[model samples]
Target: MWDPVTDAYVASSDSGAPPNGERFMLYALSQRTGLPSLPLTSIGYVDLIDSSAGAVGVTLVGTPATGPPATYARYCVARGTASVTSLVGFVTDGTTRLELRVRTDSTAPGTLSVQTAIAVAGRDVQLSEAVTVSPAGGDTARMTTDLRVTSGGETVRATGDVTVDTTTRIGSGRMTVSVNDGAFATLTLGGPDLVVAAEAGVTLTTADETTLRALFSTSFELFGTVRVLFTPVPLSRASPPVDERALVSPEES
Candidate 1:
C-alpha cells in the first residue's frame, strides 16, 4: 500500500522518511509531468518546478551578482518556446486528431505545421525538438522530425524519408518517427518505379477519415534505398484532409 504522510511508493520507514531509492523513483516519475527535480544540490535550497513547463510562453529569471536584484538573491528562468516533457502520446482536438513532428529545418516556428483536409496551424520545431499539444478533442497533427520517430511510446525509430501521405493514418498510441541516416534513399515520386516502406500496423487512411486507402501500419524497416523525386513533403492536413493520391489514367490521349 501507499502512504500519503510519507509519500512513499510502499510503506514508510520507521523514521517516517522514505529511502533514498524511493525518493529517486518518485522524483523521476514526477519529471514526466513537467515537474522539476528541484535544487538537486547538497545545499539547503529547494527548487520548486512549475506546471507550465512544456508550454511556449513559460519564462525564468536569475539573480546576478552585480545587481541588487530584489530584497533577496534569487535565480529564475524564462521559457523560450518550451517543448513537451517527452515525445510520446497523442494530441486530440475534441473531434479531430493530430500528431507531433520534429525537423532539421532552419526556419523557426515555421518548420512545423498542423495538417488536415480543412486547414492547418504551423509551429517551428527542429531536430530533437520536443513538444506537447492538448487538442480540444482528438485532432490530428502532421509533423517534421530528424530523430528516428519510433513506435510504441516513442521507443524505436523507423529510418527513411518518412511521409504520412494521402493514405496515411497513425493509430491511437505513441508513434515516433526518427529519420536515422543511410536507412533510406531517394524516390522519383509519380514514376512507376517509386516505392515506399510499408511497416506493419502503419495504415494509410483516406480523406474520408474512415477508408483504408493503404495498409502497412506497423514498423517499417529499411531493406533497400528510397530516393526522393520531389522534396521531402512534410506531412500536413490540407484541402482534402489528405493529398498525394495515386491516379489511374487512360492509355490513349
Candidate 2:
C-alpha cells in the first residue's frame, strides 16, 4: 500500500511504512505511452558517448595578464549556453584555448554552436570563435575554446588556480534508451571513459535536449530521480534500444 499523504512505500499487510532494511518497489506512470503507468522497473540516466556527462557548455573569464586582475576564471558549466555557476578548477597564463564535448540532437545535425567569454580588468577582449565538427545524431563534438585580448598574445595557457567561491553542481535529468532482448545481450558504448558520480533522486539538466527528448520518447524505460514502479515488476535490467539494421551492413545484406 502507498500512502500519498506520507509519500512513501508501505506494505499491504502492515499500516506502517516498509522497514528501512526491507526492500520494495515504488510505482509510477510509465513514460512509454500505450503502456499502463506502473512501477518503473528500470531507471538510468542519459549516457553520452566517450564521456559520462551529457552535452555541456563552458565559459572562460579572465583579467589582463599584466596587472589588477591577473588570473583567469574557467567556468565549467552545463546548458546550451548559460551563465557560469560552478567551477571545476582553474588555470592561468591567460586561458588561451579550451576543449569541450557538445552533444548533437537527433534532428539538428551539423548545427552545433557554443559561447565563451573572457573579461580583462582594464582592457577589451574578443570572446567568440567558430569551429566545424562532424557528429552523429545523439553524439558529441569536441570544440576549441577561443579568446583574444589587447596587448598580450592571443594564446595563453593556465598558470594556476583562481581563488573563487564556487560550488560544484552536476547536471541531472530524466532520460531513456532502448535495447533488444533476445535471451540476454550485452552492449558496450565506448567503454566508461567519462565519470560523474551521482545517485537516485538527484535533479539533473541536459545540455542537448533534442537528443535526449527523442530518446525518451521512444524508450521503453526511463531514468529519473524517483524509480516509479508497478506493484508487480520485472527483475531484468534496462538497456539502450538496439537497431537490427545497424547490426548488419549493406554488404552483408
Candidate 3:
C-alpha cells in the first residue's frame, strides 16, 4: 500500500500468523517535482527489509534526476546479536566518486574502523583510519587518518589526527600535505572553513604555487581559508500533481 503521508510503500504477508514470523518490507521513493530543483538534482530510494534474525537491513540508492545519470548506493546491516552494524556506500556524479565503509560493534566498545576512497578527474585518493570512542573521557572520539592521492603524474599525500567531541559535535584536526613526496603545506580543520599554512622550511616554487592555486584556487595564497559553496538550480517546467497517491489513498473534496 502506498502511504502518501509517509511517502513509502508498505507490504505485509497475507498468512494469518503472528507478526513476529511474518515478512514485512517497505520501499520509499523521493524525488523533487517542482519548478525549482536543488543545486544537486537527485532522486532517492530506500529499501527496508526484515530478516529472520529479527534485524532490519536497509539499502539506499540515489542518483541525479536530471543531467548525467550517475548512481550511488548505500548498504547497511544491523545484527540482532552482538549489536554489530556495518555500512558500505559509494557516491558518484560521473566525474567524481567516493566510496566509504564503516563497521562498529557494541560488544567491543570504543573501537571503530573506517575506509574511504575517492576518484575524480583521473585522480585517485584513498584513506584508512581507526577511531577510538571514549564515552567517559569527555565523550569524545579520536581518529588518525592516512591519506594518499595519486594521479597519472604527480602524487600527493597527507596524515592527520582528528578529535571529535561527541556531545558538542565539534571537531579539530591538522593535516600535513606533501606533493610528489615533498612537504607542501598543512591544513587545519575545525572552524567554519579550512585553514591552510605552509610547512616550515619548505619554500614553494613557482610550479608548486601554480599547482596549489590550480588545486585550491587563485586566492589560495591571499586567503588562508577555503570555503566550498553550492547554489541551487532552477527548473523550467512546473511540477505535476502526484496522482499516484490518489490510487492508494483517496482524498476528500
Estimate TM-scores for all models: 0.20, 0.19, 0.46
* lDDT of model 2, residue 224: 13
Q: Could you tell me the lDDT of residue 253 within candidate 3?
A: 19
What would the per-residue lDDT of candidate 3 be over residues 101-167, giving only the tens digit for each residue?
5443433344433333334424455433332322336555554545555665777766666555554
What C-alpha root-mean-square deviation, in Å, does candidate 3 show against the real structure?
14.9
Residues 1-253, candidate 1: write the lDDT tens digits: 2333444445434342222212111222245444433332111111223334422111112223455322111122222233211111123333433332222111233222211111112422211222221111233323222223323333223222233322233222222232233222221123232334334544333431221111112122110001011112212211222222211110111
Which is the leading candidate under lDDT? 3
C-alpha RMSD for every candidate = 19.3, 23.2, 14.9
Candidate 2 per-residue lDDT over residues 1-253, each given as its tens digit? 4445555545556332223222232344346553324443322111111112422222223223345533332323222222211212223345453222222121233322222232433444432222222232342222222222223434321111111111211111222222121111111112222122222443334533343333222121211100111101111122212221221111100
Q: What residue pairs are clashing in model 3?
A: none
Q: Candidate 3, 72: how far from true, in Å?
A: 3.5
Error of 1 at 190 (Å): 19
* Superposition error at 77 for model 1 (Å): 13
